[model samples]
Target: MIAVWKEWAGEKLNESEWLSLLDLAQRESAEEDALVRGDLPVPPPPVSGHPRVTPPPPAPRHKVPDTPPPRPSTELDDRFGPWLARQLRRSGLTQSDLAMELGLTRAAVSAWVTGRAEPRSEVRRQVAKVLGGVQQFAPLERWKTGAAVLIGVSEYTHLPSVPSIKNNLSALTEVALTGLGIPHSNVHTVENPTSAAQVHEKIDLAMEAADPVSGGLFIYYAGHGWTDPRNGRLLLGLVESNQHKTWTAMEFDRLREQIADSPVGSRLLVLDSCYSGAALDTLSAGLSSASRIEGTYVMTSSNATNASRAPQGDHFTTFSGEIIRSLTDGIQGGPRVIDTDTLFRHVRASCEEQGWPVPSRQIGRDGDRVELMSNRWGQP
Candidate 1:
């Protein structure tokens, strides 16, 4: 049998390759035969004095030194600082005056304005509030008025099991989140999570840590979302074992519960997966305004029947790319404000121009209209 197998295997390779293949096959056959009879083989322990096979010493069990965590990588100081500086100058206040109002040292204010240092979250909010009141400083409108939470997930365990349409979806979300001023501290990217329970914990922690009084919360997911084979229930893929696993879309209902119980002004959920529209339906129904303050807006990459495609280059996923563009160009502060309807229109047009399918959504119970102030939208 061995001779016959080798002769056949040799037909596809050269002499040296055939020899190499034969050796590998023999080793595999020996291992297989050993396992079939339930034979257990034990190897000798490592020799302590052999230079080539020295025994390793037991590892020390000690507590690792607690180090201060690295600063979050929002990098907002570089891009937003000059713009803020200009706004401050136009406010007719010197750094000293601004510092006095913000209760900071002159040097600290100068550092923030000159990009020498980044301001803390509270300082950023104070600056926005001050500029928000000035009509001349209206260009910084969104920065001044609204606060937001951005969430993104990227790494997956089973690459093949990942959704075919959203390969670059996480990257797209990252770019959009960073560009739109969502602090890195708020961005959560899970890598190769192993269980549904882990997914729940990470998401719960992020949502719980979010600010309740800002503009809204944004959640972005990019991975394989599955429907339970048994019940046809939607599931968000999570890491489990050596393969892909899933969490029910219904799990997000807990987020709505938190929002319902909190004083958050508004909420927005962005999903990039199949049947994402359906997920929104489930989520919206779970959330009620009975105890909440504002409405929830749900945007999906595609309709329930469609799939969202990966982004084109360094750009965001089609829907998210357009949304970020709209935010950057249409909401950059000006007299003309871009309302939610207009923002969606822009997103639709941009997607249409790119020949990608348009995103669909169901806006639920929003009492106050969401708008972005943009000079490009024209006087409104």
Candidate 2:
């Protein structure tokens, strides 16, 4: 079998070709052994240039029983129905009263509850206004204790085509974090690690060393991110003897869980790589507390629809460079005071001004908005 595989490895065999060879070899070997034992007759080899025989006709297809029609696809009546329902219950608002207040029909409210229809955009806006008006809906708050850990892994031991642009991104992140008053002690960089295990171990160490007394924990990663087609899990590339073997994004989520389970306030994760947006949803599922108070805040360099790219003239990517600039703005006192929204706006503006592709940002909290803390003056 080993010899056969080696011989066939040099040839370009399709699936059928390989299967045919295997079948023929197996049958020949079995018949040879049978004849040796005088237990069966052995067939002679076919003559050269013999005509090929045609295969017998296939059996006729039988009609399949009709399957029952699938149930009608159901959609939530309120576009924000699911989210609104949760918010209403949290705020102690009854469906009827809430519907009346929002000028929505009672039946529409019922459909929302039953998820038979979705709220229109206008309705969602009104609902948001109500929630905001009463302070029933709030953004997530920054952690009061614990430091964030940002890790950037770049460079590859094998695949040279895999760019080393992450080095620039790491530099920008480091500078930004530093400008933001995130201590150097709280930041880590992993470059061209020999194996995925080493990268995972390093992340574990960083998470372990985090200071829970600081308020919030932040983790950032910039590298080659890949997804496993079979499992739909995200993966981070590392320097490996075999390029195929790399650390999975699931491992990072595990690391996040370790930090979140601790007494630390909250965890924030920032990933700058291809397909990072998917990681947000995947990681959110694994967190024990999906709320803003318990789980981590996730920000990706790009939306699931886009790919992140390295900057052309600079070592950093456009997003990383803009974030750094925001942190360094008015840096006489360290990172400028900026809110999360403001920071993102600055990033967006910079990208636009430079004609660089802008990456989308999404924020998911348990039930509140997330507040980013920085000495840099401005909103996030």
Candidate 3:
């Protein structure tokens, strides 16, 4: 709608235009609601004298101007600090007004004007487009590195051991997570968890320690996966699991519940094992579907039926190793900050080429891209 309006008007809508449009919409909505509720209008009191004497003609109202006040000094300026302040003063716009136009916070706009902080390239481009200025934007000095919770169980008491999983966890922590700029202490690892309690406990602690308002969350699991025949739910077998005592394993649905309750705005889940697709299913379910406020990403090594092969001599499982390689090696060719969607496509293509089970991905429509790692070292 905004695009159509911009195209029709031959320019972006200014603050006053946006506010007037909103006010008109709200007034129409209120009238519709009153009509639906069958509220009758009250007539004005009848005139007492001279059977309603004629009144003088009222002055006609004029339409409000569509264009915003023009800015002075229209020459291009690459320095955002001076450019931003000049535009604000010339157009008679406050920092708050510019913030509304840019869909950003007033503090963020203030920081850009005051030289306290710089906007990322994407935001800088948006500012240029909306306010009409120099289009060039420099890369951020530092990116925001997020937190991660990695869980890998290679040894199961009742199931055949998946030895390569341990290596997968190590590579994910040292190579992938660290390469993405996640701090060593912030990357929590749970290896060969003996019971479900330990896995959830570690996850809860990581989520608690993370500051979700600023960064993202990544959860990776590689282990022996199973599907309960009766309920068709997925389970990740733990160290003490057995056929009769199934309480030892971690259920995918339970993990989904936990993730849904997380306060974080961005979450990425990567699983490698048989029946890992069940986790994807749970992610698509009603309770776990991505909301407008938060992004949800799920990537499984294979479908529920296919097995994730771990070649005997390889240090890591075929699927897990490919993922690690994709992150570290592929980072050079891709954007400085690698998002999960792009990384998934690269990994999936490799798997298909190698005759391995193709990975599956579920990305939310409303959710923004979730960054997995930054090619360059970054702060936070």
Tens digits of per-residue lDDT for model 2, 1-380: 22333334334444444333333333334444557788853333445766434322222213211232221112111123444565566544678877888887788888876767766545654654454333311212333223454555555555443344555556555553543334456555655555555555655665566554445556667666666666655666555433255442334455545545555545666677776666655655555354335444566677654667774455566566566666555223333234555566667666778776665554545311334544334322
* Candidate 3 local lDDT, residue 101: 80
Candidate 1 ranges with C-alpha deviation above 4 Å: 1-149, 161-215, 239-262, 288-291, 311-314, 331-335, 352-355, 372-380
Off by over 4 Å in 3: 1-145, 243-245, 286-294, 331-333, 366-368, 375-380
Clashes per candidate, residues 3 or more apart or on different chains: 5, 47, 0
What would the per-residue lDDT of candidate 3 be over residues 244-346, giving only the tens digit for each residue? Answer: 5556678888888887787776777888988687677667764345443457778898887777788777899988897787765654467756677878887
lDDT against the true structure, per candidate, is 0.49, 0.51, 0.65
Better of 1 and 3 by TM-score: 3
Per-model TM values vs. the true structure: 0.50, 0.49, 0.59
lDDT of 2: 0.51
TM-score of 2: 0.49
Q: Pick by lDDT: which candidate is best?
A: 3
What range of 10 consecutive residues in model 3 has the weakest lDDT sum?
134-143
Model 1 clash pairs are 139-333, 147-215, 193-239, 194-239, 194-240
